[model samples]
Target: MDEAGLIERTKNPATRESLRRDLEGMGIGAGDVVLVHCSLRSLGWVSGGPVAVIQALLDAVGIAGTIAMPAHSAGLTDPANWGQPPVPPAWIEIIRSSMPAYEPATTPTSNMGAVAEIFRTWPKARRSAHPATSMTAWGRQEDEITARHDLGDPLGPTSPSGALYRSNAKILLIGVGFNRCTALHLAEHIRWPDRPSVREGAPILVDGERQWVEFEVPQIMDDDEFLPVGDAALASGVAISGNVALAPCIIAGMPQLVDFAVDHWRAAKHPATPR
Candidate 1:
């Protein structure tokens, strides 16, 4: 079928029903903890956009389960960059005003875009990250863990979003591909800790006050670009066979209980490689 036709099919109620069933078949039920990686555009429109997706996911898991998503915002001038080149004042204000404000708690950190704003409004949530990458979670909060190590760049590499991948942490990634996965870096740190100590201390401007923060972050290899990709076989392989398979599953009129986990590698660009 045509691309448009495929998108329409996946957005239909039939597709939603199938997705629900598929989720259940995959053992995503009550008491399970899942971390979702998503592109709202890829899912198309349901009765409610992201809100509906969150609700549907919650329902499938019932009251005892937990759902998580990544919510990150980058502030180039964040205290860590105090000595760096001055940033555009107006852009900094825009980011500051737009970022969601949450009462710090012991649960997961809340820092993704609109999703962060939505979850932050809920009580009993916390915000955590190394520097640039931020995520929100509920149930078995890791506030203490992140707070102890929230350091480095306020933007770019050292953002505070890397806390989601703590050692032996059980997480579920959804919708988005592996390349976008932010938690896998922690696994890399676990694998290698003595490599130039890339993690550093920085300052964050909060409530008109400069707050110093520290974090452990991955170093950029000579060929590295984009989000850091971990080589852990368990967390670093492609789940989707190709765009062809992903397109149909995302666009099909019904959902099937297929194993859809994947890790997208951020392979280095090599001019010598055959095109």
Candidate 2:
């Protein structure tokens, strides 16, 4: 569908209400901290886009709730010199100047080019436990509903890419599933389900700095094997596959999610999110 059409369907009251019902039934509510993993394309928010979904989630949770999404943006230039590699000169300047200004709400853990303005407004949100493996919000910033554990594997310790749920943590697969879950990586870390595999290194650029960070990509699961399980995982949460292309309303909605996360996660925890 065209972008405008996507926006219209997304803003439809019937679709919105249907989505709200599905989410509420899946244990999303006030007083419950929820870490949402969403695909802006999956929700079909033609009118609202990613921002609308964020607002819908907040309304579901009410004042005493938390919501978060990944704002990671990394740039990789030189492979041989992983950590000390100089940042791409052009990207470096762009990130430092643009990210903070457009969206200044971010912790040190933010990915390349993610605007901090979104998260900075929400002082209390925790970064996701694993930023590299995260699709929404940094690992440390996720709400208490989902807890992350580090496996201690220097190469791929942050995210096991396995299926392991934490206390009170309900996996909201959204439009994607098991392959995308990265839950299996957690299992690989503990050696519970399958054998862990070694992976090659990749590059990424961080905001506000002129250096590149190298990452080791783990072979936790194969795409072919993960397809089926991923589909099953979707049943665990609300699954809406639609298009959303509207720019104005979505821009307005983005801030609400940011505000909700900061207030819920709190600012004191931002520094600790990356580690």
| Per-model TM-score on C-alpha atoms | 0.55, 0.49
Query: What lDDT score goes with residue 146 in model 2?
Result: 24
Residue 184, model 2: Cα distance from true site in angstroms = 3.5
What's the lDDT for all of these models? 0.41, 0.37
Top lDDT prediction, candidate number: 1
lDDT of 2 by residue, 88-164 (tens): 65665454334321112333433311222244244454443333333333223244322442322321333322211
Candidate 2 CA-lDDT value: 0.37
Backbone N/Cα/C clashes per model: 25, 64
Instruction: Determine which window of 10 residues in candidate 1 has minimal summed lDDT.
Output: 250-259
- How many Å off is the CA of 163 in candidate 1? 7.6
